[model samples]
Target chain A: MQHYRRTEIIVGAFMLTGILAIGLLALQLGKVGGLGEKGYEITATFGDAGGVRNGGDVMLAGVVIGRIKRVTLVKSLKAKLTLEINNGIQLTTDAIASIRTKGIIGERYVRVSQGADEQFLQPGDEFDDTESAINIEDLISKYIFSSGSN
Target chain B: MNGVLNLFGFMGRGLLRTTERIGDGTMLCSRAIGHLFTPPWLGRQLVIQLYAIGFGSLIIIAITGAFTGMVLALQGYYTLAKFGSESLLGSAVALSIIRELGPVLGALMMTGRAGSSITAEIGIMRVTEQLDALEMMAVNPVRQVILPRIIATLIALPLLIAIFDVVGLGAGYLVGVNLLGVNAGAYIGETIAKVTMHDLLTGWVKSAVFGLLIGCICTFLGYRAVPTTEGVAQATTRAVVTASVSILIADYIITSFFL
Candidate 1:
């Protein structure tokens, strides 16, 4: 019984520690994405989502300001993404929503390039100026390989 | 012709035996799980098992996690620096550790460290007729022994994975920044900036599932130990092997499901 008691305490402590660690990680992730209160929601449509999944970061100027909330196909060809953007950061109607890679061939994230316009994008408004993710390798390969054939 | 016929006969028998064992193992797992929720829950035994599974395995997990991270960083820098894309190393290390290395390696390590012990301990009890004695006393062996171990494993595995992630990420940072001359602030900042809740959560879910499987495999193998001492040793070996293989196979299944 004593031996069992000792083992149980140790395992419980370890389990608790793990749960706490995950909690801390969640907090850090939240802080990084500016999740929770003070974030606004916006929607965008794209012909192709290009590996952009829900919870992918929404970046402004290469810095993450929000996260993707949900992704669904509005039509057979068009995909709609609901983004949670941080408060106080306004985006103009002309803002371009481009799916960008963090590094070369890295995970895909949505990047919003703020447009020079006075009209701020309201909640639930779809951004029309959107670009799908560019595969740099494909572009380069096409350029190098196709240029020779031509 | 006789020799070839003999070889084929041996192969067929071996295959049949393997299939029978797998079927029995599956049945045992179902029984254990079914028994788990049934009455006569041994809360005290559960606690003790948790301590053994969780606390006893920490140091090994930490060491492995840290070194794996450090090695990944070192290797990542060496490869990426050549292409002038050293900046990508942070994301590479973070994604690799979070997505694949963290859960799989952590579970594998635990399979060796904790799984073997669980098998041996249970095997010893079975051989000594302690399990039978409990049965004779009208105590539910599954509840008193196997349940605690299974519950402990399910609880402990994720904790080990969490420790691994933190330690591994930290070690990777150290190697990337201090040893490899990458910008410490940039690496840390990029990692924090890029990592999402989904990535971390997915890793945790995988670890938890793996933990449960490991616990089940080890405890089941241990519980099925025969009366002979040799059977106990064989059961221990089988537990370790089964747990490790299952962890790898499950990793693939979980990855496909999540990604």
Candidate 2:
């Protein structure tokens, strides 16, 4: 009887540990970040969004405050990004949203530079200033041609 | 001549035996599954089996996970450093462990540990005529004996895989960030960023399927053993080998669909 009880207790502990492990994976390590329904939406357009993927980070001063919700091509043949920013972080009308790569060949993300304007952009409002991703090949070719010409 | 004809007859019998065995195994799996939800819940039997399978195998699974993660981090650092992207080591370790090694290696280890024992236990019962006695009493041996084991394995294995993944990622963190001097935030952040819910779901599904394979194959092999000591030994051996090979084949097929 004692052995049976011990087995039940041990099994219960094992099951608990397993459940905790799964919860850690789903909640902490997974990308189902709590920004699902609580964030404010804003739009940013760029000539080239580069490899900025959906659910990519939106960083402000190197801190993530939002995620890229969607990426679509506008009628202007440019990229339009829908961003879901956290509720408390406010963006001004003059804030500059730019597509930037993390490392040399790392993932692409949006970096927002805060502007000094007093007016704050509302939900669904567009960022007036947007910078497209830098093409490293274009920069290298231009540098080589200019140096050769010189 | 008569020699050639005898050889052809042997080969034909072998092919027929293989096909018959496959059909019996499939029927065993379906009947056990059907018996799983019927009356006489056998909750105590399930708890005992869970303890035997899940708690019994925890240490070995965790140790395997740790070493696999540590080695993966070391190798990943060596390769990714060549490209100056050593920061991706965490994601490398996490993805490999969560997506493949956690399920495959854990299932393989469980087959050797719990699975072989399951086959051996049932085989011993058969050798002693215990299963036949139960059948004589009008009790379905498949329901009385096999159902608890299959249900316990199905419930225990995915939990074991979850524990394996967690332990593996922790060990990888120790090797990658603390030992290898990779930036701590990047190591952790990249792991969190790169591993999505979809990846977790894939791991869960794979582990569950592997669990089913192990339960059915091991139990079926033991339930149908020749009721002799030597036959029981052979059945145990065959159970481990067949379950391990089936897991690999199923992993490839499941991964193809996911990809």
Q: Summarize candidate 1's per-residue lDDT along B15-112 as a digit string, tens digits.
A: 99988877876777677678766776667777766666777788999999999999999899989887776876777798889888999999999999
Fnat of the models, one by one? 0.59, 0.73
Cα lDDT of all candidates, in order?
0.83, 0.91
Cα lDDT of model 2 by residue, B108-216, tens digit: 9999999999999999999999999999999998988898888888999999999999999999999999999999988987787677777888899999999999999
Candidate maximizing lDDT: 2
Residue B105 Cα positional deviation in candidate 1, in Å, after optimal superposition: 1.1
> Clashing residue pairs in candidate 1, if any?
A7-B51, A8-B47, A8-B48, A10-B51, A11-B50, A11-B51
Q: Give the per-prediction TM-score of chain B.
A: 0.93, 0.95
Candidate 2 per-residue lDDT over residues A115-146, each given as its tens digit: 99999999989999999999999999999999
